[model samples]
Target chain A: MNNVYLYNDSFNELISLIFYLLKNNIKPTNIKDVSYNPNLFEECIFLGIKSKEQDINNIALQFGYYAFRCIYYVYLSNNESKELIIYYFILNAIKYRKKITYMRNLKCVHETLRIAEYVSHETHKMKGFTRFKEINNNILYAEIEPVNNILELVSKHFEKRLKNEYWIIKDVQRRLFSVYDKKNFYIIPEENLKLEDFRISKEEKEIKEMWQLFYKTIGIKERKNDRCRMNFMPKRYWKYLIEMEDEL
Target chain B: MELKEKLKILADSAKYDASCSSSGSNRTSKNGLGNTAIAGICHSFASDGRCISLLKILMTNCCIFDCKYCLNRKSNNIKRAIFTPEEICEITINFYRRNYIEGLFLSSGIIKSPDYTMELMIKTITLLRNKYHFGGYIHAKAIPGASEILLRKLGSLVDRLSANIELPTENGLKLLAPNKDSNKVDKIMSYVKEKQNRKFVPAGQSTQMIIGATKESDLDIMSKSSSMYDNYKLKRVFYSAYIPINKDNLLPTLEKPPLVRENRLYQADWLLRYYNFKVNDLLNENNPNFNILVDPKTDWALRNIELFPKEINKCSYYDLLKIPGIGVKSAQRILKARRNFTITFDELKKLGVVLKRAKYFITCNGKYFMSSSYFKKEFIEANIVLEDKSIENTKIEQLGLFNE
Candidate 1:
């Protein structure tokens, strides 16, 4: 009999599900979140099991830190088979410990490493591509629609880099905002945000025009290649980019 | 004058420079508004497909020297503008807070004297760092004839410093930029090398040279880059294809810049830096220029075909890197994965190997991935050329515009 595990789309809940499977030695046929649609053949197991902070620490201890990180990053990737890949990845990791990491020839191990790298690469690109606009009372607001669940990672990076500013990073697809108050940040839902309260500053209008002009003139006219521009900054990212607004 | 007008004049002139990297600095914010990442970040891409990591601009376009190749030469009839130190600080801070750029790249034309120009740059940067408490990456251009003390002071304030060796040879410099001396550029490089205590230019020094404006071959250019790396310990050497801005009798009249050659030189530059290949290994007196068709690595592999059919499962990491398509990362992956289980040809593709190029050069488990007929030089070259048709089309189409 095949068992399919279903849970919410949260990293903590995913960790709890992994712990439940490892503790009970249950081999899950497929692992998915609540958003996943299931077939009639498999037995659906709704996992309401939640692991505490200590249990997560135990999971980290059981599987090596590097392997645990790989699993977490794989879970964050947009790959449809990432859950099953992680399921097999953890089982092999627990069986072989450090040796499994070097076994990249295995299908599960290779997929796990590849998917994790893709997510991290996207996060790094987001760090550079996220553009902030000044709103009312000198607060900064930026919106991004990334493929992965990378808001926490990107927010952590800006927490160190842009530590002195009050900013909000809104993940448009997830409908979540990582709001930072110059000291600490919290992930809040869209319902809590007052859309009408946000107003663009007059100075910001002039600055935006200047930036758009700068972007237009900075490129060499002799070397203009739309293919190359789209290669680095994909067309998908153009929706939020102020400079690319004209091009789009 | 409005700030937007001045930005247009200065940034248009500064667009010719090719260096926009923000990597190599690890400066963090301490009660400041910004910080620098060691790995660097590119904020945007220009329409030409170049990375824009910094707000590259000039302090002023009013140059004293009449460089024949420069758009901002003294003899050129163009509108000029200058930014005050306070104006620069305001723009930098505002743009930085908005995350429009990683940092600033400030360069200038010689005004009155080199020392006077260097002093103005120093004042602006010091104010930005001290008064504004800006902790972001700053790349300053070192005037070749400036005093050592001013260069030293500017070096400590900025993260990266560069002095462009505009043309390759001394004759090219004399013909194009008569007032600039090559020896002064070397002196600044040596001075920066001596003051490498991490407090001075923590990201190290870099230099750029214009290609196709001079008669220097690929061999001559690569030889110079190799020496600069060894002597000055420079971080990077940028190659900018000479764009025909001011048409002089001494300059070659071309319809478009030599982008293919510039791209080939960068490929060869990576080989020198990462692939452990020397100048002589890729080019010599007989073959002084890169083959504009295939990449430098593929060309080198074709020339040195006796070392081919390297066993992917048994070859060392460096040998795997020598393959035409296997890069450093994929080679490391192959090395790690092969230790656990034997890597097949299909598995090699999964490990990120570009098998279209590597199939002719690599073997899997003592079996040839390609047919024995592919061992012929002509056959492999034809197939490789076919694989790179898109790159060839872009180059030819750009050059074909001039021919018509």
Candidate 2:
């Protein structure tokens, strides 16, 4: 069968393009995996579906940028329909463009910014509500798989709050980790491994113990407003928060 | 005694204050140390179900003044504990490291004098920020009658600051908290507002006024709150419905707090800030308090029925926001969706607008749907759910109790 490349009038067919190139026994090595050969002796007769893999990769990467911009636009507008429209727009933008700079036009950029604002706002809200707990291994582990790409935004919050310690914020849905040592933060991609298998420091245990003690002491019995508590820190996030598990 | 025991006592005493927000101020890590998230963190919940992120504790439960409404009022017999500045700082830093708290909300009773209590509070904040490098959010209360220098010093270090307005009026303050002066509290608030103007307390100032204490009508309370907002540029005005914990001749003996009243006030406050509603719009001489049956917005809409059935296409964003249950989000959604197609009642529901309330005030295709006949008796009957017995009876009815 001919390569099954799904194409829309708008150029958002990068995944389909990858699928087609791989299906045709072609390994994408450079940006020319599906390029037309100009030096062919019979140009009119020959339909070259061959291009450098790098070219395909570059085009795919460019489309990724356009897609991200479109998603951001939908986010700022808080328009669910804009989400579908953005997908169509990016698909079209990619099919027609080779240069990354050409995709960074005003219209695409503006839409991306609007979505970014909304996504960023929600991410910020999650940062406040995301609670962490200490386990036996001494790792200050917080698990929040937020609806948006808020890993970086939330990681910064954990880094600042837990400044003088080591912690890991795991996005369980994405299977990504924003790990922070006393010094800096770095992202860890999921490698089909459990977090418990990872190494933890002894000092982390002492800090966790101290923290649990502090958390236990601060709550006042007379002032408990369960409805308000649930309003601010929803039960959906209880699994990751160490102290909330027993209470919940 | 152990630190845990002291913390329990202090937190219990502090819980009644009821302002536990951590938002405002965006602090990030610079010295490879702590950072502040603009979205504040709530680490845990108390028995009453409030989020406990900050180590919300008073320095001491010992008070000289006899505030009749207060649990820790000097005459009330309760266990009192005072934490040294070092103890508070250590607990705050430790809790913060474990990701249990965003920072400290250190309040205190008048341990000796307002100045001395304020000084110790200031010292605790200074130690946390400078010694511990605690760049996390700090919400410190400005002690009424505390020296101006102390208030200014505390304001410079903390992220958000508040001075409890305590009561709606001077007469209420006199009757409920005899020693506390309304003008003195206003003076402190003004000081906080001035410091906020001078680049201190970057989150601006907020104040709490106790509701249902001394017979101040909802109109009196809301008007004071409105003026506080207008003059102070206050970040928030928190309304805590008074729960009479201590028996006092001065205060009313109520079984439970007027929670519905508090809820109505919050709704009214939202209208004030976002819906361009004035205090007078919600209340006047004829309607001194919010109607218990319906929300303030719906009540206002019902009273001013002439504004109903506004054209969705022609109505400005502000005008669309006037409809009950159409908040900022739904209004914006309506604006965007209408750009692509004309919005019908069905489409409006899909856009997340509350049709039950909006049905009375809005229309589609210039055709009125909600008539007085549909809502006249049913709406009044529907609102009887706010009554205590009706709710209890409904609960019993749900459990299949027909004979009784």
Candidate with best lDDT: 1
State every prediction's TM-score relative to the real structure. Answer: 0.96, 0.77
Each model's backbone clash number: 0, 36
Off by over 4 Å in 2: A1-86, A89-139, A143-153, A156-164, A171-176, A181-184, A189-236, B44-49, B336-340, B369-404
What DockQ number belongs to candidate 1? 0.68
Name the 10 consecutive residues with the lowest summed lDDT in model 1 chain B. B395-404
Give the alpha carbon lDDT tens digit for every residue of B190-292 in model 1. Answer: 9999997667899989999999998999888999999999999999999999899997999999889999999999999999999999999999999999999
Q: Give the Å error, residue B172, model 2.
A: 1.3
Across A1-248, the per-residue lDDT of candidate 2 in tens digits comes to 22222223112344344334445545332211123233433222222334445644554476566444444434334343343344344444555443322222234433454466667666655665565555545567778867676787777766656666667887888788888877798887888445665555565556555445545554544444555566656677666666664565
RMSD of 2: 8.4
In model 2 chain B, the worst 10-residue window by lDDT is: B377-386
DockQ, computed on Cα atoms, for candidate 2: 0.24
Report fnat for all candidates as fractions from 0 to 1. Answer: 0.79, 0.42
